[model samples]
Target chain A: MQSLIVDLGERSYPIYIGQNILCEALIKPFIKGNQVMVVTNDTIAPLYLDHLLAHLSGLSVDVTVLPDGESYKDLTHLNLIFDNLLKNKHNRTTTLIALGGGVVGDMTGFAAASYQRGVDFIQIPTTVLSQVDSSVGGKTGVNHPLGKNMIGAFYQPQLVVADISVFATLPDRELSAGIAEVIKYGLIYDYSFFCWLEENIERLVARDADILMQAIHRSCEIKAEVVAQDEKEAGIRAWLNLGHTFGHAIETHQGYGNWLHGEAVAAGTMMALSLSVQMGWISIEDMDRVRRLFEKANLPVTPPKNMSSNDFIDLMSVDKKVLNGQLRLVLLKTLGEAVVTADYSKEKLMDVLSA
Target chain B: MQSLIVDLGERSYPIYIGQNILCEALIKPFIKGNQVMVVTNDTIAPLYLDHLLAHLSGLSVDVTVLPDGESYKDLTHLNLIFDNLLKNKHNRTTTLIALGGGVVGDMTGFAAASYQRGVDFIQIPTTVLSQVDSSVGGKTGVNHPLGKNMIGAFYQPQLVVADISVFATLPDRELSAGIAEVIKYGLIYDYSFFCWLEENIERLVARDADILMQAIHRSCEIKAEVVAQDEKEAGIRAWLNLGHTFGHAIETHQGYGNWLHGEAVAAGTMMALSLSVQMGWISIEDMDRVRRLFEKANLPVTPPKNMSSNDFIDLMSVDKKVLNGQLRLVLLKTLGEAVVTADYSKEKLMDVLSA
Candidate 1:
């Protein structure tokens, strides 16, 4: 087992990565109270809820299974979790365990954050996208009809248990989607890691457990460091959303769950690279390498064909990155570096869109 | 003008209490962004929205008026604020100003807490209940159908401006409701303040600016100290909910807004005192004195005659104060001191309910 700590002072918790460690003893210490509620979606509840129940068997555990999809990540579904909690009479001491992918993790984390003003919860992220990114950062929320992740909280979890064995059951496309975030670490901060990803792309796609473990571990380490410095995203944390600005536009336009979050991010990263190349900040060869790496991982390499430049601008305008009505984009300075600023010209942005 | 600071380290904010001090100069320093969205209810928007707009004339300000009453403090109303924000393309830099009473303040605070994961907001509480209690501490959220304040966050405000002049427009019942919180500070922590209230109840009832200012200032001070010690209600802060357990049941049973929050709290405090008397923790005379003080302030002294004991027990059982499935009550130790415990006898509790 590999372990890492998100050093957020008192709000910090440990992340444990391994295969088949979802047994009771490993999860017992993190259960702060006797009342435990497990929040998962229908897709995952059938696959792993029983395994989780085996660990929580001796204690009082209730389960709330929401419909499985990004589309289901809204206030209506969020209320189901709260309804279950209220019905079961869960208290402040109750511990909520999010036992699915990013959607489940986001819902449970938020429910825990607001339930009784806040409660402790554990993340058992089953998807690579969640294990590597969303689960580690304490970023939990639902999407609004107008935008993605528009409603949520930065509530950290007591523990995140990422069992690598679950990847064997992940659909091929979902596995590929998760790799987009894994690739994000390289494009934004680690040049050598970007190179490493280029070399190891085939092994990751083949579900090679050793290579997959390496990817999840490295992604979490990068994320933990960024979150520690700016947990609230006041400064450098914005860099973590490099592909998110355009990606959220795609998600919002295409409607959530129609396109996977990581898939949209993959395409959005490509657009960001095109803008970077237009600015002469990164060479076309580097941009190609980035695109080829994503292509190798089976991720999308362009924005959806139907989305117009005006649509992108309109959708992106509502982004949280908008500061004083100016859209701030996170662009690559080089293969392993990125910068968040509103300095790019409209002409350059238009060129990338027109292309 | 009188000012007191809630010393919560990085989250600290000031509470300014005075008459007709809602001018631009007093509020401008706290506006972090050029875009300001003031969230007010229908009743208050017609009354004070223009006055607030006058102070914010130069900035890009948007006004969202929600329906008035506690029943409107739900997710649907909260989404109205979000819709206005997204429609106006308000960014993370935009500041939300909650410009009504407790319902508006609570909804706006929760919206700011969750919008874009988090944003800065200032409180311009127009009611004594909000100025004295909800606005000072960071306990911001909306209610769920199952329970009051069941869904929310502990998000603080940037500043709190309590213009005492607004009290002149307050209905007699609302003014009396506000005094319930004023009396709470004394009942929970300060004996001398309780005696002071006994002496000046008539002046406060008449909305004497000088006496009302004194009451609001002291309440903020006592609340700030308790909150600074335990911002998240891990310990001593629970004492602040002396009458809230029974009170929340009333709110939940009667439906939110049927009985005002302060009114429910006033009657609930009497129940807690009755329990204290049964426990031999306080004399019957002290309980009667407490009841008389609330009556003097025109606050409720007894639980609504229609609510059954079983309903109260069932409702209170789901309170946030319940731990390990046991209900914890905040009971008076003597006159001013209070203790939160589950150690009371079941028979004695039954006796109080039966009586």
Candidate 2:
């Protein structure tokens, strides 16, 4: 198993990844077991909750499942987790284990962070989107009315167990969604990873074990390094948000959970690349590479036809990245290099939108 | 005006104290007017919200009046604040300002810290308990089923406005509770401050302007220094929890929000002294002086008749100070110095209890 530590001082924790690694022993150190709460959603619980619960059989584990969707990543859905914990009388020592994809992971992580101030929780990420992204960083939270992850904490999980076996159960649509985040790492900071993704897109789409492991491992390394530098999403951590500024706008406009996070990011990344090309930061060839690789991964490369530039800009304003009402866009110079800049002119933004 | 700065790198903020210091010019910079939410308990809003809101006259201010008391300082209460922030279309730029005492301050601070991931919040602390303790620490959170502040964060407020005039309307009982924390500062880290408190307890109980200011300033200094050393409550910052270990048990056993926090803390301080003397860390005469001072200030100097030693032990087991189910007590070695030690024997605890 490969592990990465999110160095957040007292809040530091470890993220572990490998095939067939979700057994109890890996996460026992973090579980305060008189009462344990497992938070997941319908989509995940039916598929993998039993395998996860099998580990908690000896312990007094309470499982609570919410409807699976990004739209449910809000306070209303968060309360469902809390309602169970409260009903079960789960205390500070009651550990929360999030056993699902990013939507479930983010919501569960947030539920742990906010329930009774905070509680211990571990992540058992089932989807690639989660194993490589949400599970690694201490970033956990639900979406606010204004934006996704608008309500959250840089709360690290006590332990993160990413088991590749769970991914076989993921639907094709979900599998493709997860790939968007995997591709994000290459576009933001690792040129070689981008090229690697370009070469291995077919295998990854086919769920080739060796290729998938390599992608998850490398994505986590890049993420772990960025998170180490800015645990609080203050600076370099924002780089991990490549495609997210526009991706969030898409997700919000599409009404969260409607568009899988990875799909939104896939299209958002294409726009970022186009914007980058318009800004003269990257050649058109770079944009084409991103589009082709994303397409090969079965990720959407275009915005929904109904989306207007005006609507996109309005939706983008609510993102956490927009500071003092100025919309900040995360555009790419090339794969493996991303910058969060609002230096682009409206003329450029319009050109990309009008494209 | 007296000000203390909690230098927590990017999270650092200021705590200002004085009479009628609520000028718009003083508060506007910290007020993110895109949306401003003021959280206070029912008891405080009737007494001070109109007066406070009058200051933010030109800004878009929204007031949320929660039920009064510490029992209300739960996720149930915090969600009310978060819900209000969103239901009103408040965005990332929205600022939250906590009003009222520690309960309100802590809940609001947590609300601000978790709302939209985090938002800027200012503290208009009306009660002395908050100004000297909760208001300065950025330790924002609500109570948990098993522990006091078991769920919380070191979320700093943008500015802490301690308008002394709010003291004029304070209930005599509540004022005495605030003094408990004021005296706590003197007992924990500053012998000179203890001497100061010993001499000025009477003037403070009667709410003398000059003496109160001195007490508030000195308390802020001690807290500010400890917070500076350990912003996240990892090391020496634990010392600032002087009477809290015992006090929380009392509050919890009695049912939270039952006794005023200061009243319970006042008794807890006496317990700390008794424990200190039992361990030979504090002198008998010093213990007597501690009791005498609490009496003079009209604060409780003994644990309530209702709670047994087992009750205290059970309640304290979940305290933030308690590690791995073992209790860590903060004992006063000298009138103004405190230490958190796990060395107390069960026999010693029984002896103190039976004594």
Candidate 3:
């Protein structure tokens, strides 16, 4: 087992990565209060709720199992967590445990942030997608029908326990979805990690324990550093959304849960990379290198066939990335470097979208 | 005009208290973005919305007029703020201006807090209840059916423009409700202020402009000092909620809008003072002093005749003040001092409730 701390002053917490740390006593110290409410989903509840609860043994524990999928990640379902907490008499001192993937973690973290103003919560991510991305960042919120992640808070968790052993149960498509974010860390921030991902993509796909652990650790380290510097996404942190502007449009257009977040991000990242090539910032060969990595990971390298430039424009306008009336996007400046800019030409953007 | 700052480090903001300050350039400096959305209720919209919008002529401004009242201060109605924001393509750079009473302020502050994970917001509090209490502290949220303020955030506004001129149009009942909180600041922290309220209670009820301004300024000064020391209510800040635990129970029991928040708080404050008297912490004369002031302000000094001790206990258990299984109550050690304690005897609490 290895741990990395996300340094956020008083809000700083550690992310623990290991084979089966979920059953370990590592989470005991982080439970600030005697009362614990574990928020999971129907899919993960049947699989790991009891196991997680078993580890939470002497504390007064309650469970709220929401229906699975991003479609359920809305205010209506977010209320269910509040309902369960209040119904069971969970108070300001109670700690909420988010015991599933991103949706559960996001909702539960948000639930913790808003419950009686704010409360403590632990994240035990059960999928590769969550373990690599959502679990590390302090970003927690539910979706609005108008946009993805449209309503949320920058709330950090008490502790994040990412037991990769749970990923053995993740479907192949989901595994590739997780790798999409893994590839993102490389394309946006680190060239060496990008090369390493290129070399070890197959082993990660097969779920090799050590390789998967390395990938998760590296992704979190980069994310933790970015978050520590710019927790609220005011400046440099926007680089982390290399494909998210385009990706959110795809997710909102297709309706949430229809296209997995990382899958949409994968296609969105491709559009960003293509735009980068057209701008002459990076060569076609360099963009192709990142494209090959996404393709090898079995992720979508393009937007949906039916989605048009108009759809992308309309949906992307409402994205959180838009400042004033300008649509700013995270575009690659070169391999291993990214910049958020609204300076790009519209005709060129339209050309890339039409392509 | 008088201005004071709520010193919350980087999140600190100024509170401008004066007559008709809402129409001044005081608000423009606080707006961090070019887009603005003014969230007001029906009652206040017809009164002050256009006047507030006139000051924001150059910016892209939109208005969302919600039904007025505390009953509408819930998650369902909170969605309307988001719907209007998204429909108008308001992005992260948008600043939300809450232009009404506490209900509108709480919802707008929370909407600003949760919109795109947070945005800049300014408060133009028209009601005395909001100008003195909710506007000073960064406490923002909506209510749930099961509880009042069950869903919310501790999000501060960029600026608070408390235009006392608007109170001239307020009803007699609403005027008394605002006095309840003004009386609270005195009871919990300032014996001199309490004495002041006692002597000038009738003048305040008559809505004397100078006297109300003095009361609001003093109340905000005390609140700002307390909030600066403890922003999240971990310790000294809970004293600011001197009557809130019992007050929230009364509000929840009366079904939100049925009881104005300050009126319920007035009654709840009496209950706390009564319990304090029973505990031998204060003399009967001291508690009576407060009771008389509530009476003079046309506020209730006791719980509803139908509400039983069991109702108080059942509702208070879910309060944000409850820690673990313990029901902590804020009691006065004397006229100007308050302490949050779970050390009281249950029988004494029952005595106060049954009375």
By summed lDDT, the worst window of 10 consecutive residues in model 1 chain A runs over A319-328
Q: For each candidate, what is the lDDT?
A: 0.91, 0.81, 0.90
Q: Kindly list the per-residue Cα lDDT of model 2 for residues B116-172, writing each as its tens digit.
A: 677889998888888888898788887765566756666888999888999888888
Ranking by DockQ: 1, 3, 2
- In model 3, the runs with Cα more than 4 Å from the true position are none
Candidate 1: stretches off by over 4 Å: none
TM-score against truth, every candidate:
0.99, 0.84, 0.99
Q: Per-residue lDDT for B139 in model 2?
A: 82
- Tens-digit lDDT string for candidate 3 (B1-355): 9989999988999998888666646778787788999988889888777788789978999999999999888889999999999999998889999988999999999999999899999988888999899998899999888888888999989999887999878998998999999999998899999999999998999988899999999999999999999998889888988788888888888888888888999999988988898889999999888898999999998888888989999999888878768888899999999999999989999988888
Candidate 1: residue B111 Cα off by (Å): 0.7
User: What docking grade applies to model 3?
Assistant: high
Task: Say which prediction, candidate 2 or candidate 3, comes out ahead on lDDT.
Answer: 3
Q: Write the residue-wise lDDT of candidate 3 on A42-84 in tens digits.
A: 8998888888888888999999989999999999999998888
Ranking by lDDT: 1, 3, 2
Query: DockQ for each of the predicted structures, in order?
Result: 0.87, 0.29, 0.85
lDDT of 3 at A85: 84
Interface RMSD (Å) of model 2? 4.2
Full-model lDDT, candidate 3: 0.90
